[model samples]
Target: MIAQQAIGLIAISALASACAPELYKRDGIHPAHIQKRQHIPNVVEDTRGWTFDQSEEWNTQSPGWGACFAGTQQSPIDLQTSWGFAKSSPPVFNYPKALKGPLNNWDFGPQFTLAAVADDNTTEASIQFSHDGVEETAYFRSWHTHAPAEHTIDGYAPRAELHYVHYDDAGIPRAVVGFFVDQATAENPSSGSAFYKQLESLALPDIFNNQTIPEITLDLNLAISEVNDYKNFWTYKGSLTTPPCLEGLRWFVSKDIIYLSDAQLESLLKVSTFGARPVHRVWGHQVNA
Candidate 1:
């Protein structure tokens, strides 16, 4: 009987191990959470009335659910690569060498805002692209990360997603580039592995709070170029994935998948919840690749 009990214990241990993140099997990354050994003062947990936990309720619970559920161009629609066409050209990024800002945890997720004017008052980092034969430029506003990816590629969601928000000359959010992120395991070390590690190391504020971090070590040029080839992406007319779910925003979801390392992701999960809203309908919007 004692021998049979030992075998049962082994089986339970095997099952538990199998459920761990597949990347942790070989990468012995350090635990990234703040412990009793380290602490911050004057920091508070971020708060929010809307959460991705109850995404279905977003249509009614959120104050601006009218557009979120009833709108025709709601964002984060599944992108089909086969829809590629020659009618549009990919946007050209004028991203600078570096950026400095505070990392804040808003209701959606951890947002690295573009400070001072936030996403509205700056054209420092911008993207230039042609849509419908009209050339336009959109300035870099801010960027954020979400888990399980907000946009799915051909109906399959990736491990994570990164969004770079851009505003027009009038300070209106006119463009956003969405990149799917995969886990960088030892078997497949991703181009974004180093970049993401740098971001994960910074001391961060709790959810809904903001922490002033020093000038970041990230290089905007490398961050995007390394992750994507910059030529292959899908463009469409859509709305905001968050509250108010405003419509008429320009979207460029990339075909290239960026890879975030295990350590980087574990650190993020410590501060963020699943942020991908449920996929919306295309409503006849021409998704040009």
Candidate 2:
């Protein structure tokens, strides 16, 4: 009887281990509520309305939905000078001459998710940034777009904001380079941006296929270089603009705005959610560069 009980216990242990969900590390810390399921969740899978604004289904309202409300450091705040003091010197970006990847395009329910193919050779793509104060290098993970932008800059909301989410070696989100993009008027059409062009291409096709597409390449260097000035930006600490609203993020809102063609903006709007969480009411948390 003793031997039989021990055998049953061992079987149960093995079964539990087998059913355990995969764990991912970020910022050198792992929270039980946060897991990188599917690299990124396709969309708010629950009964929540499609966009981030669906507070009805959030952790705050639902209890344990995630950190959306329980946490104080929510993002999408207005990037104003009065909030935080300016930094004479800010973090510097060490971008590669070029980025290589067999990128995959996911038709994430609300917005498109363009991620690395997750293989030995395909994972080599990354960019680095460092500020004089912080000793660690922030590495690029993936980037995505939102129409009408999320975080506003000095009361001005651009047509779109490209969120370059990056992380450190320990899986901590280091910095997010928010490149604000304006729509080009007929007089000065900003058709030279390759990054937005690539995004448009991916989105346009998905409209027809309605499926995730994998095995594509994008020149990340060319896309980043489209911005005229990367140095003049704002810095702040905030939470992930999305659900779970994870805080402790380092944010950079670039003053150098880029231009996106009307056609490109149209395609993006067709694919992504209207925008993200509203600009929070909290103030006094911005640093000028």
Candidate 3:
């Protein structure tokens, strides 16, 4: 009986060894998804908060939907002439000191207010600006969705985009600048830059793109590359370029134009409607050469 029992036990042990489930091996853990855990830093979080009184008092009402637009003086004007060397004009800035209080108190820096305006006699469109500060500039070009127009400049090919400018009640001119870009290249001059890439990598909300969450990180450093050259530019004082257009802004436009590849221009047009906004008249503001 003892020998029989021993044999049975041995058989059971052999079966367990052959059929036992594989040891529960643990798999490597992955790093947390940065996008899932990232947060956008509001640079002007502590700036003076905007109240109903402030908005009403300054005549700077916020846009209800689409874009929270602002009304100002010296809105964007049309670019009718070809690119060429012109005489310089004296810089005339009489920015109101009191107006700085309200602007400086706001939370964000200049918000991008893009408008596509008619250029010259062609059906071309371009972007305009209303930025905070003495001067402002942006590279304008057709996104991947649009074709590039040939021009004397290396990177500037005419597409449909214009640049504009304006000023708030405080006497500070809202510098509207435009950048002409080509989208064909993989390198994104603005978002692709090292700094902007970092901010973009953060995957912040695209306020314009249905607040769609971005997949890539955002690099804030690209802002450092803003053009400072004001030698060649158009100068004038006009009204807010958009609806409810008010008057009284001092404008300065850069003479040097930026370029974008074909791909970039099309990408912009695809997102926004093919036509931005039409360029308004220069309105009697002195066009200083």
Leading candidate by lDDT? 1
Q: Best candidate per TM-score, number? A: 1
lDDT against the true structure, each candidate: 0.63, 0.53, 0.30
Summarize candidate 3's per-residue lDDT along 125-148 as a digit string, tens digits. 222333233343222211111122
Segments in model 2 whose C-alpha atoms lie over 4 Å from true places: 1-50, 61-67, 81-90, 97-132, 186-189, 199-210, 283-286
| Root mean square deviation (Cα) for candidate 1 | 16.1
Lowest lDDT block of 10, candidate 1: 18-27
Off by over 4 Å in 1: 1-48, 59-64, 85-87, 117-120, 185-187, 206-217
- For each candidate, give its TM-score against the true structure: 0.74, 0.68, 0.38
The number of clashing residue pairs in each candidate reads 2, 8, 60
Q: Residue 22 deviation, candidate 1, in Å?
A: 31
Q: How big is the positional error of residue 28 in model 1, measured in Å on the Cα after superposition?
A: 36
Better lDDT candidate (1, 3): 1
The predicted structure with the larger TM-score, 2 or 3, is 2
Ranking by lDDT: 1, 2, 3
Give lDDT: candidate 1, residue 113. Answer: 56
* lDDT agreement of model 3 with the native: 0.30
Pick the winner on lDDT between candidates 2 and 3. Answer: 2
